[model samples]
Target: MRPGELVPIRDDAAPRVVERIALVRAAGAVPLVGDPRWSASHWQQVQDAASRAEPDPQIAWAAVTSGSSGRPRIVLRTAASWSSSFPVIADLLEAGPDDAVALPAPAVSSLTQFSLAHAAEGGPRPLLPRGRALVAQDFAEATVLHGTPQALRALLDAEGSPRLRAALVGGSHLDPALRARAEAAGIRVVAYYGAAELSYVAADHGSGLALLPGVEADVRDGELWVRSAYVAARYLDGPLRRDGEWIASGDRATLRDGRVHLLGRMDDAILSASATIVPEEVEAQLRTLPGVRDAAVVGLPHRTLGALVAAVIEPDPDAAPSLDDLRGAAAAVLAPAHRPRRWFMGPLPRTASGKPARAQIVREIQTGEWVRLV
Candidate 1:
């Protein structure tokens, strides 16, 4: 291994991923880590793509985005870009030498891999699972946790991991209802809004995501643009857009009272009857419904309306919510146009990183049979 050399590290084992990433850095090579869980061909596609990527001398890490919608993207950043945030994040998350971060998720995700690297550099010790799925034993020594909303919910449902004092959640929206529940459990939930490409945007310690130090942000045409010393140097495909020092975050948001309110990905907007509906805005309200666990809103094809506002929900197993129930709850919070015209209930497709897979759900709804809720 040499500086600027591309080293392919194929291993999905959580412990090994941490070890290998640290090892690769010491050897001065860019570790292009692939998920061993991926089929050989899929991994090959990633490796082949990386082969053509122009080498960067300062690059220390390379990772593929969780391709939930389309082709996964390869991103690059220097080791210091992440290390620079550790001291601040440690204070924000309340991480200490006594805290052990339990990481039961797959190793390939940006958040997971980042935590591994973070722990190695004295953030917190990472408690990795020895098996494919997390069990009670995985969290025995853990005190603090970082996960997506879905993963956090799973942790709450499962037994053990009792030592958890705080949870640092990201990668998707953390429902206000869910955050309330976590607080009731005596856990300090700190939800942060960020992109894999743009590492740490803003963090919320129960209030709302305010800009972290060293990060500058603004809104233009309803989309968020950020300029920070910590952002990724470039995407493996090409350079990121920069207007002066700021780069478009690709998220629709509003800057109200110095808080960053993420609507959703710019691409997740639903066009129904000439109105633009952000699915996240609706989904957040829907998740507050008593029986709803998670929700995904999409533009379902309709001959008369072009695309109807459709909602696919992962309902609570104990009490499945009806379409009328969701409508009634959403009436006060959401506009009539933003309300879901049609409803569906199912397991709700999700990506590896645990975000709702809108693209896959659209495909399944169009071709496959989902239990439609009336």
Candidate 2:
């Protein structure tokens, strides 16, 4: 498809999804997919951006980011970029022609759209349910399930877990306890680390996530750099920092024994009292503490320290651990400055893709929307 030709898919119906896929793959047209819940002005902005997008003959599909951090941008991907991973992923899932793939998320999400395209390639077509609420009976004939960690948890919470051949969980970090519980229910959990610009970087079946086949990964300084055939060409409004074939992923990681252990995003570091703190590292320790159901950590403005570490936690129903208890639990794992000075207890706000909305949570805490528990 030529540049400046964009097809916006605003509908989530099955027919519309099928038609859009055909246009992109069969007819060689670039299809732009965005969240249907977006406001009219947002759609207008997308249209304007699409019109101004430069032509790339290799571009096959375009998708908007979830905008959890800020305004979303359009990313362009080629057919070969994604298609190369479909066979490998399908092999991992043991998907066959008669086996159905259940996609609970809307087609607007890049993750869901990729699953749909993967299914269309020689596997059974994916089942797009109306809402995120999925039941075991909904995918009785399906063998593979794909969605965010939060969505999968909700489905399992609502309806007892279904025995599936494989469940692909991404879009957010998967807690170890959650993965254990899902596996206990007879589902093979396959967790992956990826971005909107990079389709599939690394995946973990049971062990830690290793770089996928045909992908090269390295840690430059602390940021993860990935080079693969699956990376998108470019973003419509922003530039992807590139060093030849390698793209700098903003995520921080450490390579040990040929495996990538994600630390957190480089941009999420908080400079407090001359000490650098990664909120995700603190949050991981917080999740391991007793009575903590979920946690989110963010930096708030401080007079002397520039920024103060703050945390929002959701306590277990029958066990509300106090601030002192939280500190005691994390005392062995985290540094004094890494611990949260201000703490709030409640459910953490999340984006459409189920990632903790860190910016929004910080805003609420600063505006006093969430009462300080500590």
Candidate 3:
């Protein structure tokens, strides 16, 4: 079987390699069995956990990359596929065996591979299952801390342990203000960019995100395309469009000098009555104001306009900025159509990956569960 090819093994499957061999035989494909570099026992444990979770193992040639599409699913990757993506990540982070990094996210996610691969020791330096509340214990060790933006925010709130010297924030947008705060707090937070398909293409290594070594980034008609060592083989569902060596990334980006400034994903853009608006643009402006710890911008259905911009902000407890003040600030910096029509101040919505859940925000707005902007 090819690397990342799903072999249907149930939770009760045994002797993983041997069982997988049999399964592959049954499926009429040759099986590679195991890789010595990563632990077989660990692989068995992972397989067992996966089987227990899902009774039917419908193996596929490719894996699905979720989160961007709003569903958690696996995408296919070959041993070569992942290998092609690693060097750029290593070069971007300037990583080596000496680098000790704390990865709060699970090792399974493509999102965490940059941290996992760079650390060399691999896996969680120490896994601390977050209880009902986040604890600061995780950041006590390791020079590099990798977490999603929300995870960083919560960790900063719960522990704020300024222990870790540098951070790599991913799986969501890193607001400039938040990045500034982390810098001010003595933790250098750099926002890295990648999707499951392209493990890591670029990161904010300099003033803006620098394209990782072995990666090519360019924008076409406002959509971003990445030709890199890291692009995945294919999606489990189907093949993804590729232009020559480059993969069509759904994200929108602007390449300035050698760095790229990412706008939000193209699908997330909201078309109001007057014009199309990117919520991130509005969110970025809102985040600059004082008292806004975290923010999520979403398009909610409106009677007249197809969608109205809504700002859901998590206010800092110590100093909360007034809603009117936020609106006024938006008015000064943004165009009339670009400003959010309503502001909802509360704890922001987030996904399991620690990225803001725009889908959840839309759902809440539709169901009237979310607080109305007054």
User: For this target, which candidate reaches the highest lDDT against the unseen true structure?
Assistant: 1
Looking at model 2, the pairs that clash are none
Best-to-worst lDDT order? 1, 2, 3
Q: Taking the tens digit of each residue's C-alpha lDDT, what string does model 3 give over 133-251?
A: 44567555555577776666666676545556677777655667667767777777777877777767777843888887778887999989998656766654456678888898888
lDDT per residue (tens digit) for residues 1-374 in model 1: 77766677776666676688778778888888776655455567677887776666799877776442113468888888888988877887789666799776666666777787788788788887777776767887888887777667767788477888788888655778778888888889988877677889999987889999989899999989998877888877778877888989888999999899987667676655434576776787788778999999888876434478888989899998777877776654555557788789988878999888888888888886765676
- Ranking 1 against 3 by TM-score, winner: 1
Q: Candidate 1: lDDT of 224?
A: 97
Candidate 3: worst 10 consecutive residues by lDDT?
63-72
lDDT of 3 at 226: 91
Please identify model 1 stretches exceeding 4 Å from their true place. Answer: 68-71, 269-374
lDDT of 3 at 348: 77
In model 1, state the lDDT of residue 133.
Answer: 76
Write the number of the candidate with greater lDDT, choosing between 1 and 3. 1
Q: How close to the true structure is residue 73 of candidate 2, measured as C-alpha lDDT?
A: 70
CA lDDT, every prediction?
0.77, 0.75, 0.59
Model 1 steric clash pairs: none
lDDT of 1 at 132: 75
